[model samples]
Target chain A: MGNNPHDAGLTEGPAPMDEQLVAYLDGELDDESSRRLEQQLASDSTLRDQLSRLERTWDALDELERIEVDQEFTRTTIEMVALAAEREHQEEERRRPARRRRQWLLGLAAIVLACFAGFAGTWYFLPDPNRQLIEDLPVLQRLDEYQLIDTIEFLKLLRDRQLFPAKTEDASTVREASPVVAAGPSAVNREVGAGVAGKREYEKNRARIEAMAPGDKRQLSDNWRRFDKLSDEKQEELRNLHGALQLEGDREELERVMEAYCEWASDKLSAPELSHLDRLLPAERIEQVAAYKASPRRQFGRRDGFWDMARNPYGTRWFGRGVSGSSVKEYADALKTWAGRYVADRAEVLAELLPREEGTKWKAGLAKAPADDPEQVKSRWIYLVRWYLAGPKQDMPIDGEDVASLEALLSPNARKFFEQIPPEAKKREIPVGLRRMIGFHFQTGQPEFENLIAAEDLDRFRKTLSVDMEENLRKFPSAEKQNEWVRFAYFQSKLPRDARSSRDDRHSPGSARPPYGPPSHDGPSGPRRGPGGEPREPGDGPRGMRPGPAGIPPPPADQPAEKR
Target chain B: MLEVRDDNAATFEELMLRYQNRVITFLEHHTGNHELAKDLAQDVFMRVWRARKDYVPGAKFSTWLFTITSNVAKNAQRSRSRRHEVNLEGRDSGPLGVRPLEAMAQVSSGQIPARALDRAEVRDVVWMAVQSLNERQRAAVLLSKFEGMSYAEIAETMGMSVQAIKSLLSRARTNLREVLEPYFDFGSPPETSDDADSS
Candidate 1:
């Protein structure tokens, strides 16, 4: 009997005949199993009844299969299959070239890499021309210090002693020479003109300096290149004066002047100005004297001050450090207001200047200009303002007609500002705003020579450079170089046409001549001396060495400052 | 298949003609869209021709052909669902001669009679019931009844076990009986009385 629940009612049970009946209906079973199931179906009425039911249910599903496809179905399917076969063959053919091209590219890359590797290996062993320039960076940095030395012979003596490293092949031969006692013929001219006490000071300092280690001597040599160019006696006088300043007593007026010379050197006063400092207004002279006074505490005697001078003498660090916190907040607020006004103005200008579609493109490009950095945001706004004022040529060629046309576009105050500018400045197609900056710098007497403009104004001025000029400037794009260019532009305005024509000959790109003018601003005492050399009672030097009424004060009761 | 693999176009045409209606019928029952069924059937034959080079005949040509047909139908249904529209009301011309219900229902008076529908109406009722089964059950029932495939053959075609095919058909039968029993009169189906009596 099959163990079927439905058949259980007919014969207590049948041995799994229900599933076998389904298998028999589907023809899934082998002949033996099928025949057996059929025999069971014939003999057992109940099992036979179950098979009949399965047969009827299965047949009923044929009602779903009644769909007779259209007569065109077969033909269409064959056509499609044939078409697909042809397409696949063509597709394979199409892919063959791309596969070949990819393989070719890979092969080419491998060959190029091999060639590069071989070239790099060979280049590593060749001599590099700029090697000495890179190695001498420390010496070049200390060039201002070197300028303090007055006697070339004394420098040669030091070079012979191996205190200074040879900077070139010619210098190397001098390093091996024996020291001689006789002063060279230029000795008379070498008098630093620092009077007798200054002479004594040099002898005294020489004793202590002579005792210093070779490395310490080398460091001093590295810093004082100008000292070598000094006339012989001036070198001796400066050496003596450097020693006397270390003493805490009175010095002669001559020693004071020599002390002032060293101070000017340390301050890195530009070369042309350094040579003429003595004749400068007492205010400028006062700076040279204060530079001496500030030295003992600011640099020579203090480690931090020395490093500060070594790393950045001009205080250009201000560019990155920005102003104090309160000023930053003020600048930030001002920037926000300025940006808002420019954007509003830009909308009307863009609508007037461009067709609607192109206007939207312009708007999108301007939108991508960065706004996060206040300087960059100000630059972008300045660019847009100039674009509006200068019209299509953002950079108008410096000519009177163009300048007048640009001025016509400016506000009343801006036009009035340009009206006051010198006729010479009007001839250059300089941006109106930059002309204002230059005029303000000259009026202020060029305070902070390199950093003549405020940081915000400097950012805007840079955006005014011709695109080509701006690209050329990017090669040496340090904050210092940018300031140099700003300073150069101001000086360029001052140059006669002939001088302006030879502008590139005046200085290298990085160190253009400082604006040709007297120094101004800030000194230790009352108002800084006007360019008119006014005299004031001298203050004690950095240590307490004062220049008394008589030339040299008698040595103080305290054991005389150490003499060699 | 061997002749087709040898690049015999005539042999391939013969094979396609033999199965075209069967494939279309299976797809029609699966998708309930005669136009889509026709499209899918054409794609199935296209694939069979493309894959002819890789063909190795197994148990039955119908099994292999219907396996491809089953896959094509499922892929079409999946894509159709993603397209997010289903025309359950049948085609504008009615799917494969199974007239839309509005027309079919009009032939009968007011309420549908308890008695079996005529040939056209029966086909429509069966198609609707077939669509009601989930995809797997629908495939199982169609392959089993229309192709007369044994449980093993259906299992191989549908990628399921023989036991799974049995359960699938069992469940499908239960669902069809529920939806159709009202109209079918199970034992005879009216027109097949001789076959019922013989059993």
Candidate 2:
């Protein structure tokens, strides 16, 4: 009757009795409902029977008893709660100063913004033609007129041009017009009868006479009309000695003159190079300075490679000079190799960090992937490198559209692994191939590398390589032989599997190892071979077959090219 | 509640003493283990103390107190499932007393007359019947009988509506009547397995 099949005989055709019965048995019914159920129970045997059973079940739950709880339980809980509160209080106190500093920075930024707005408004709206004309006045004036003119002569020209109007021939008028020169023979008095051009010439010579020293001034006073036309360089040289000539003590004057040439040389040297030289002992500093002066001037043309640009301290590269193009390429290759070495080092670190199963999976991933396509390999490497460099905690937002492509390229686990790598490790252990790639990519305007390798660092790297190159040249008979020696250096350093230590001494190149280039997927295998396709010796390869160009100086006769 | 919120330690201890026995009784019936009930009761009071500042005092103190009790019970039940302990043998004594099977045998002995069970036997019989119900029904019945809460008050404490509470209690009573009617000698128990009463 009330969709109440589950209630069975309790209800006929009215509201369901299931809830009513449960409530009634629990004494939850209102007064009206309670009276109604009571009346029904008195009249109906079936209703009374249902009520009786429900009451029995409800009353049966009274069997559960209140048991005693240990007193120590209450004591320990209160202690824990107090400790938690105290910890929270300390944390809040620690954060107060940091919060105050953030507020102060916000206030300062607002003040600076307001001041800039006001200054911009004034500069844009205010316009005065007289001010504009004064700025433009220089373009209208002729150069020859000012060449012989001192400060006073220019003011007279200003008046002659009617830029300033004169009042009369009064004392006050002359004082205001030329206060600096009023005590001398005034320009106004000269203009009264003398030829205008002749008067200009007289004033120029008079100004020169006043500025000269006592000896020159006395000679000028004797023949004030004629002046010697000394060359510009001689004039500058003479002027440089002027302070010393005026010294009161003869001994001090002589000392100053004697040190002038050294002062001139100091200005010509590179500041960093000179500072480094200063740190050396006096004897060493002298030798270094001599070597620097004798070092041939390298043409650092714009066409020259990055290595040449690195060698020049001032960073000026001309179009036509320095090392040959091939040598520049060789240095560039070494940098690229160094970058590759860094990546390999990081791979070793990664292998250690990965769990056993994951490490195996990663190795499989690398082995299964194609190694022939360099671009694909590079892209995969870059993806890992980019994620590694961003740091573990970095949250990079990706568009919904990009999710599929990223998932296709890298597995979710691999992506998470990259995120977990700490950035501090990335900075300290720059992957060998990454630095050169970053430098080259950033050459096209990548700003991320600004912190990685600054200009100063690049210069230092170049200087070290340049020194290595010089040493290499002196060790080999020719440039071709040196290049050949570098290719086989790594393998030759270690003897064949059975070779003895005594054999190592026969060909060891000492501690001077050649720069190792980046490893290729199909790197050289087996034994080493020289450029001529012959097995290389331990130290220097076969030499003295031919000499290179004139620029390469020969080694000392006692140490032959083949003996290195 | 305000005294505890203000860090009055004595007031908090007094409150704990008043409610500790009631909480332990409810949890023992719900879990069918008196020892676990005592531990869970301690946890409930600790939570109340920790969350004292958050209390608004809108509801009765018992209502707030029981809410935390229900939460701790539910969390412990979930962890127990994940751990999947196959047997809890040799741990017959719970927060209350002996195992339900042993209690059933003691109550069923020919020596005890129907309707004349001793207080200890009655408590055991009732606890055995409570274990027959599911977790929610057990909690609902414990709150109603032990705490003396009405349908609406139980609903508020358990985060359910009054109508739902009434339905829950009805089903719970039907299940209990079937399990308990035999002990009272009113009717025979239906052919049922005791495996479902392992709680």
Candidate 3:
């Protein structure tokens, strides 16, 4: 509609003519514009050329590839939408329960308003049965234990007297420090919190009750009925006892004591006598129980058997089973054979346990001993086996001096590997390996000192030493001494080149190499001394020089070991 | 579409079957990445499913669907730019950087030998030229050229005025002409330029 003749013909630069030309190519122009564009295209060569270019470029867009999505895309999209819908539905369901509870409360309120006096009487005299069950669920869970005791006072008196002793020999030692009465009310209160804890306990009890089988549920209900008939004072006492027994540490000990007492009372006392004792006061009842335990009539024929049974009810009666001397000999021979095989398997670790002279002599004796001489072989096997078993128990604390000696004994490659461990990790890893080396030397007897030295580092330690050092190490009479020299050489190599030459001149190989002494706090070659220049401790001898049980020497403290 | 709005699942599936290929094709051309296009196409359909309860049946369903598609695509492009990971297929060139066709521009401008390009090369040239357009211009051109929507429908799909869409299409065509006209007229391939027109 504009009167510019230039606009009718296509011009550049945001002109309406460009839009008209594009629209004309797209067949989107109005009739008047289409007619005018056609007339202009026929006469104006520039406009025709411009239209041709637009038409050609627009058509070239068809060259872009057509794309098709696979069936999986459709399937996954449907699944995603379905999952979203299900989540929405679940959200609605979660909201419905609160709404239902509100409606129930409103209905209850209306009924109460309509018949206040009647509802109050019913609610007071016959409270909701389900609510009562939930409130008493904790007691119902332990109804069987409560049914046996007349009152908590009686149980407390029984525990105070220590009438039910531990049935096992070791059990007495384990439980001696943690007596049932020692756990005070404050401890119990600390263990169990109020309010939130109470609600959680109720929910837990309800879930357990609901999961019980129908027959068990019926029996529980029966117990509840019997329990319900007790006086309110008795019910309160039983509930208090149950809550006290729920304390974690005391529960197991008290349960065991109760079990032992129950078993003994049922076996010895008559039902009438038991009932009579229960009717007495807790103090008098416990006194009577103690008297019955010590009675001459109860002990006349079966004191030893009863005490033995009390001491170890689950233990096999190996001592009382009579056997011939020949049978005993046969058993001893079998045990000797097993011990010999075990000693042979751990020969390297056992060798490390003795002094250089003793170990060399023992190895020579074993090599020369006649294979068919059972007596000599048995004696040799017993020597090594005794050393293995009679060493320090597995749980012994690793001495810090022993750990320092072990660190001084690491080979060059192992030292490199050990130094790379972060300092915090070294504190943990060094002790674990040292403990295994000391306590389970037989198990760690495989090559490479498996617990202490990594296999690759051990291999490199043996393979990478100079010809002179290897020759010097081979001259040592025992593996332990050879290891000490390797460690000394590794430390020597760490010194500055000039200092090493001076130290080597003074400690030349033939002049009796210095004893494997404790590491010095000062420079590498300084005297080994404690912080105040005191002498080293007794156990600070060379590796494997520490005294073992029965006067035998245990293995030298080896390298810092790690669990593989 | 009304059935789909009423939560008719079978109708939704039918609609997906009808539109999946078209939607994926449009997105693939729009984003220059087939896998991302598939992901974005699924996202578009997912939004439609989520907003089904609010869907009103006035505009054409493809138009409504493309509106969601346009928004999803733009959001993806915006985030991709924010991450500074806008290169096409890990090539150091795309709409926001130097165009891949700069090398081809060198070839067209006779710095390199003018060998006859293959069909796939020509297709790639056209794809790069399309991708060089700005986000809105690219969406508009794709909707117009592939979807065959009128200027009004493109305006509705892009949430722009009819005049803006007209201007957008005109500039896009003019850009394509600058890049592709030589290829269409001669054996030389299309070259993307530094100052290629974009809205």
In candidate 2, stretches whose alpha carbon ends up further than 4 angstroms from where it belongs are A1-15, A85-564, B86-117, B186-199
Say which candidate scores most in TM-score: 3
Regions of model 1 farther than 4 Å from truth: A1-18, A29-50, A92-564, B57-59, B82-84, B91-117, B185-199
lDDT tens per residue, model 2, A433-455: 22223323322222322343334
Among all windows of ten consecutive residues in candidate 3 chain A, which has the lowest summed lDDT?
A: A308-317
**DockQ in order:** 0.06, 0.08, 0.09
Writing each residue's lDDT as its tens digit, candidate 1 over A223-247 gives: 3433333445655554443333223
lDDT of 1 at A387: 31
Candidate 2 lDDT over residue span B1-199, tens digit each: 7877765545665576578767877786676555677678767877887788888866688988998898788787667658753212112212122122222222233122111123334344456567757677788988998788888889988899997788778767766755554434311111111212322
Chain B TM-score, model 1, reads 0.79
Model 3 lDDT per residue over A1-564, tens place: 123343332213346777888988888888998998899899998677667657766766755666656557867776666565556555655677776756645543443342333333443555554555655655654554454555556666667788886355444553332332222112243244245665465555566668876644754564565456456777776666765665545565665666567646544453224445656787788888898887743311111111111111111111111111113234334334434544554555555655556555555655664556666555454444333222222211223443354444443323443455555544444433322222222221212122233346445656767564464345332454345334323322322233222222211111111122223211222222346865333223222233221111222223211111
Candidate 2: DockQ? 0.08
**Ranking of predictions according to lDDT:** 3, 1, 2
Query: What TM-score should be assigned to candidate 1?
Result: 0.32
